[model samples]
Target: MGRLSTHILDTSNGRPAKGVRIELFALEGDKRHPVATEMTNADGRTDAPLMTGATFRTGTFELLFHVGEYFRSFGAPLSDPPFLDVVPIRFSIAEPDGHYHVPLLVSPWSYSTYRGS
Candidate 1:
């Protein structure tokens, strides 16, 4: 019953971060392997769950959000080294039967995520 999903909210703009690029990586020891890459829709969500059913596993995984590029696309003036560029969220799923709704609330200066329903 477990599934992996994510969404991005652009806190600075008070809207969903549409068209944002997201990457999924499975971690193993010292390195990580790419699982999939996707671009957010108008609602800042993928058309399908990142992982679900049999493909979902109990292990550490990383979700990388390309925030800097997203903001820049809107003509937001950022620092030379943007305050927040690629935001990476690393998490572990111990329950294969649990739902992991990793939602991100982000802005040019900061971001946050949590296990959601």
Candidate 2:
């Protein structure tokens, strides 16, 4: 069965965005429903996958990162109306039995994500 998991790193600090908020949502039609909410640990990983086992389904999902707050808390200089606010990562799970790794390498001005093995 498929599972949902994520990791968040602070590219600005070259460390895990500890305590950064992460929200998981399952996209249905045009509405997004909350699956779970968690904060990154010292290792930048959630205590558990948002969902796992047979309950996982193939659909679009979103991971909302509180990058603005994360940077501000660390006293990163901003340009008054930061360039990167909340980062929304939208992707689809094509296989229920496949392992999906969506890791976010984020900075104040930019971010990147890909389908990791």
Predicted model with the maximum lDDT:
1
Stretches off by above 4 angstroms in model 2 are none
Tell me which residue pairs clash in candidate 1: none
TM-score of each candidate? 0.97, 0.92
Clashes of each: 0, 1
For candidate 1, the C-alpha RMSD (Å) to the true structure equals 0.8
TM-score of 1: 0.97
Looking at model 1, which ten-residue stretch has the lowest summed lDDT?
72-81
lDDT values, one for every candidate: 0.93, 0.86
